[model samples]
Target: MSRPLGIIIAVSLVFLVGILQGAMASTKTTVIAEKLAFPWSMAALPEGGFVVTLRGGQLIYVAPNGSKQPIELSLPDLYATAQAGLFEVLLAPDFASTRELVLSYACGSEAANNTCVVKGNLSAQAPYSVINTQNIFTALPKKAGAAHFGARMAWLADDTLLIALGDGFVHREQAQQLDNHLGKIVRIHRDGSTPDDNPYKHSQASQIFSYGHRNVQGLIYDEQRDAIWQHEHGPKGGDELNKIVAGGNYGWPIATYGIDYTGAKVSPFNQLPGVKAPLYTWTPSLAPAGLALYNGDLLVSHLVGRRLQRFRYSHDSWTLTDEYLSELGQRIRAVYTSPDNEVYVLTDSAEGQLIKVELP
Candidate 1:
């Protein structure tokens, strides 16, 4: 080859490499907010902002420009300890017009803690504080303990809300009984009244949509299918992703794929009559937290696994297609998709962060 031709080829190669590098850099993560206090959940505001909840019972309003301001929301009964605390925050479907929002948190004193949901309105002015807050729903038979407070919330319809409640750890057997609210998915109207058509409306277990859930943390409503998707943390290994059904029995302690933390078998049978099987199970337990369906894909944030997983549904089954952000090695507690389809994740740490995910 001639010298001039060699020089031209080398220059072209360098130019191509630089172009490739720039393209890769275009799809990168940007930290929107950092140094948070154990952020558990976040919801994007309709007007281009966010309302984030911390496990230590604080609410932070974040502006689009990355500025953070603390919002004072009164919660005199908030019980913040261990795995209990403020959990999920979500805006109403008609939030743009009503400025209404909802949140789930551990309420009551430490000796009698349980999951509770509050509905309130957001102020329009700066600081964007919460006002007129009312405890719309509270799990029954409030048991003691800081673990297993399944306080995730999802809007099943325009007028209905679904709140996931855990077994309260020590009362796992009550999950199979219909006399109480532990280990169940409860559905209620916006005013915290039982819907007229609930499956258990005529029974003693009114408001119970499903039972036998261990400690659900993630929930999402699929409008296309008119279904609810949820996930829960198991004892040692059996994490589950389930399609919730009315009056369904999930078989937590009665039929689990996990053993106790002490290495004792939780149940002898993994399959039982009249119990619904999980759509998916993680043997080693991913500690799945946030769940969202965006662009025909389900995105899951893992606390113990330390990754963001994308699952695609096709032919009535879900398959894992992508994994991301594992290099950061942070415990992701929540995932939210904005109206513009941008993904945001909250890390679970003293110096937690709100990260925006850029896709290629």
Candidate 2:
């Protein structure tokens, strides 16, 4: 009887260990929520909630638990097509003191349309109206069609605004021309005036902070480096991670490590005399869409896979250090980090999802 009892106890202990191991692995990845449709961009709000933008021109407030409240906000008539629509939603740095929110979307009259940014007040009550809606900036050379609006916004510490514009597919060569605002990152005052101190404010066709970008979908200010960083999609295999600099040019159709969609070579070489090279280039394309620097301690230091890519900055160069795939299989559209170190990501799809990275 004693021998039989010992065997039973041992078998139970092994089974318990296996169950515990499996649970830990699963807990490492908990899906806080899912089933959102065409979610585009996200802005972190106070008290641990986020306001997300949908391609259909709606803003939904999501609590930390993933419960959502669609704020019935009014949007200007927008022409959303292939890759254009409502782009980014962000709170002005002075939101707590001013209650101001800035929105970037594609807008045009029946004849011509381009990407534009507006500033307005956000109310929590019914019928959230964007009072004092002011059109601050619009991309130059309004090209027809709703493709490559390149409408993303970031703020510099000095209270200046940076807006990224896509080279309206009307002409790819326009990317290299400073006279055209398409395919360039422009820096301006909060009121939409070019800054006198801008890198190219004095040159002809130079409201451009940086140039030669294809479609810069991801833009953010990396606080630790005191620099702005961006990631843009490549034609075929040369998706890139870039450390943006004022007055600098990032070679787009010119010095790509990618190929045209037709599977032909994109550029003959990888470097050009004046254009900047990417800090890191992905071959065969991860189809990267969002970028963030992880500030939390729970993430292990050396895993570069997908969803999120983290870099370590040395004195002269950056090395890829970490990456993690989100629960949603779709492309990551945007990434935001709050003051308390919570990382938020928006996935692209008809039914998009907002995910939070929590460390156990």
Candidate 3:
């Protein structure tokens, strides 16, 4: 009832070869806007510009002319501490007319906080702001501390929203539970309603798409193969890039290739029965933070690794086709490809930047 792996890989090859007559990429970078505040994620606009999010509760619009304008927003009790902040930004599928957009941010006090998603309409012109904001969805059972509130997001082919969540650091075992939203990918309608056809719609939490992820930050939906790809941070080693399958259990503390920061073993086993294995594992910890599809390949940006690595599918798995942009010497926070097939990168720093990548 399912297509074979060989078939899928063959089709993917065709797609790569068909794009721009199978052009090989060369990396060239240019900084379009700079001096950002802890930049986390960015989105390329349907119009002629871009929007970048700083973890410090700010959204700055980078115009085509490279001028930056702070978009006004009022996220109540927006937490900006300890591996948390306002996260990803995504334009609505019909953004040209509706002007609606979504946001994922850390909400509540450090004593009790959760990952939250909100929908808001944008002003058309100068002094651009998100107006009429409303909370669409919020992760339940708010936890203490500011670590591992996974808020990365991607859109499904059916136009549903997918939000990735973390295991609350000390609560790593919850990544295997079903009653709560911690350490899972959740699917909901744009209006924050759960999708009826979700794999676990009847038994598990209606919002959960998959479970067992640790601090997932990179999530993308690939239309070419009708697949969702994600990456997450590992403790001291074993950062992973994974292909998400519905109802799949990606073992975290129960099955890890990495150890605890204290030099203790997190798990006795790195592979287990009924647990999905990673397609690729970054030993020694790449600290991969962002993932994007470039022309038919993947562009993975790293924080600790401090570089961008490109991988192409070959010999039945992702193979490193190229690597570049380490010369800029900044922690690459995120990489995004525009609807028009343009590339962009966000550098993470006190004085962050929105960079345009020319790959032709």
Candidate 4:
């Protein structure tokens, strides 16, 4: 072949590869359900549907055909304030046979509210109302106001559950304290009992797994890596994603990359000797919410950023490889993968929607 002809062919191939890469990253989003009132979190059911939570204090069962029914729940302490309300719904690992599920929500009046988790059985009939409901856990030192209720749940392979709690906005310093549950992730058995092997099992705060977090809204147990990954909201500009370590301090206010809402520095130092650094941080705040690890990729749902981010991690480094569905122009609240690996996202809005994401 002529030298000039070879050069032209190589350039054309490069341009073709670039076009294919761009096409592969593009996504198609199908709206599964719309006009929802602030849908927060959801989990796919083994029986062909989803159990979803709404920030307005409702539990909904959505069928495969997109039909929706409100699941009747009985909880007198259920609180629905600003950022506090029904937060997450998760089906048990044995849900196929047990019909059991768990819910995370806010409890108590506006004067003193805190995050809470409850376990219950769903009725066998239509509507599938929650039955035999029991309060399994509640975050301590319930504070006033409704700004930050970091209430997300993930279950380990051993069936133990991990619950993330927020710093209560006004009590950010307590996240550094070990005596309380604020800004901490706690591990407990299915029955709400603390596991004996937990790092703080023998201490006063027996269930505490890790501490020093702001408002963590995303939690996932990555089966591939056998690690718990989480992300939390920062004050102004410092959203963070971390690989949660047992008994580790995450350094909320004392060592933050974010500034106060008033633009004051949150801390003079960004890292402390005892506290662990974030695996990844987002500047100007993504306000990251839901997280899912699928096909070796970390998918994050962003609220203020109004997009979905996909990250690939390798050799202790995380790379933001793609951003999807930004044109939807909606605040994404949560993301989950179906059994077949299809990704679904929930929008945070009065006219909220559940969207299925498809990639080329």
Whole-model Cα lDDT per candidate?
Answer: 0.89, 0.72, 0.88, 0.89
Residue 294 in candidate 4, Cα distance off native in Å:
1.9
Best by the lDDT measure? 4
TM-score of each: 0.91, 0.84, 0.91, 0.94
Q: Model 4, residue 58: what's the lDDT?
A: 89
Tens digit per residue, CA lDDT, model 1, 47-85: 777889999999999888889999889988999988988
Off by over 4 Å in 4: 1-24
Tens-place lDDT per residue, model 3, 72-139, is 99998689986889999998888889999999999999888989999999888767899989999889
lDDT string for model 4 (127-230, tens) is 67999999999888778989788899999999999999999999999998888888999999999998989998777789899999999989999888888899
Q: What residue runs in model 3 are displaced by over 4 Å at the alpha carbon?
A: 1-26
lDDT of 3 at 3: 73
Output the better candidate (1/2) by TM-score: 1
Model 1 quality (TM-score): 0.91
